[model samples]
Target: MTIVLTFMPFAVGIMDNDLRQLLAQVARGDRTAFAKLYDVVSGRLFGIIGRILPRAELAEDALQETFMRIWQRASSYDETIASPMAWMATIARNQAIDLKRRSAERLAALASELDETLADESPDPESLAGQAGDLRRLGECMQGLPNERQQLVLLAYRQGFTREELAERFKRPVTTIKTLLRRSLIALKECLDGAR
Candidate 1:
C-alpha cells in the first residue's frame, strides 16, 4: 500500500477563524470537523514547532508527538484561557521541551558507546520531507527575527544550553540571559501573532 500527501497554500488562515467552531464540534465528537481541522492546522503547527525547536529531525519528532497529544487533548481546550492556536502551540512547546530534556539525558549516556560501533546510515524519505518542511519554516522565522535576538534564542534553546551557560559564553549575568529569553519569546510570539 502507498500513502500520499498533498500540499495546499495558505489554507490555515482560512480555517483559523473557524478553528474554535470546529474544535467545539470536535469536542462533541464530530469526525468531519476533526479531519478538516487537521488538514488546516498541520502545516501551521509544523511551522510553529520548527521555530521553537531548531533541529529539523528533533522538530519533526516533536511535531508528531505534539499532534498526537492534541488528538487526545482537544476536548481540554478552553476558549476562556486563550485562542485555539495559542492553546495548541502551548501543547507543542511543552512536548518539544520535554523531548529536549530527554535528548540531553540520552546524549549523556553516549560516552559508554564504543566508537567502533557502526552508525545507521539509512535515509528515511518521510523524515527527509518532514525535515525539509521544518527547515523552510525555520528559515522564515529566523529571517523575521532581528539578527541579535535570533542568535540569543538559538544559543539558548537550539543548543540546549542553560541560561547560566549562555551567560558565561556572553559574559553576561544569568538574569540577563533569562531576560533575553523571556523577551525573545515575547517578540516571537508577537511575530507569530501571539502564539504561546
Candidate 2:
C-alpha cells in the first residue's frame, strides 16, 4: 500500500515482517526504531485518517494522535492476528471517527440548548412579545458575562467553533472549556430567572 502524509509522500519499501520487527523494537522502548517506523508509516496512517476525517487539518491532528497511540500501545500488537499496517490503520480510523463524533456533539450542544428555550412558531402576538422580551433578556445576560466567557459562548454558538478549537484559542484543556460553558449557562439561567 502507498503512504502519503500531507505534502510529502513516503514509500512503504519495507515488507510486513520488517514492520513487525520495528513494532517489537518500539515495544522495547527503542526510540530510533520508533522514529524509523514513523517515517515509514506516517504517510499511510495519514491517508487512513484522511479517509475518515475529510478536513485536512483534522486529519493531520488525527495522524498525530494515531502515532501517539501506536507508540504507547506497540507492546499490545499481535502480528499473529493482523499485519502491523492493519493494526496502525485501525488506530488511525478510530481516532478520526472519535474526533468527528466529538466535534459534532460540541457543535450541536448550544443549538439544542437554545431550541429548548425558544418559543413555539404559533405567531400569536402575546407569544411573540414574550419571545422578544426573553431574547432581549438573553442579550443583557450575555453582556453581563466576562469578556472571555462571552467570546467563548459566541464563538461556539454563533461562529460554530468546536471545543478543540476553543481550547486551542483559549489555551486551556477541553475539560476546562466544557466546565466554563456549563457554568456560563448556569449563570445565564439564574440571571434570566431573577429578571423574570
> Against the true structure, whose TM-score is highest?
2
**Residue-level lDDT tens digits of model 1 in 1-196:** 9988877664456556699888878888888988887787778777877887777888999988987787778889887898888888888888888988887665544422311222356568868876775566666666777786788888866677776788898888665566566666656646555321
Worst 10 residues of 2 by lDDT: 6-15
Model 1 C-alpha lDDT versus the unseen true structure:
0.73
Could you give candidate 2's per-residue lDDT for residues 59-149 as a string of tens digits? 9998888888998999999988888888998999999999989877875785467556543456777678778889899999999999999
lDDT of each: 0.73, 0.85
State TM-scores per candidate.
0.47, 0.54
Q: C-alpha displacement of 84 in model 1, angstroms?
A: 0.7
Clash pairs detected, candidate 1: none
The residue-level lDDT of candidate 1 at 180 comes to 66
Off by over 4 Å in 2: 1-14, 114-196
Q: Work out how many backbone clashes candidate 2 has.
A: 0
Q: What does the lDDT read for residue 123 in candidate 2?
A: 71
lDDT of 1 at 183: 65
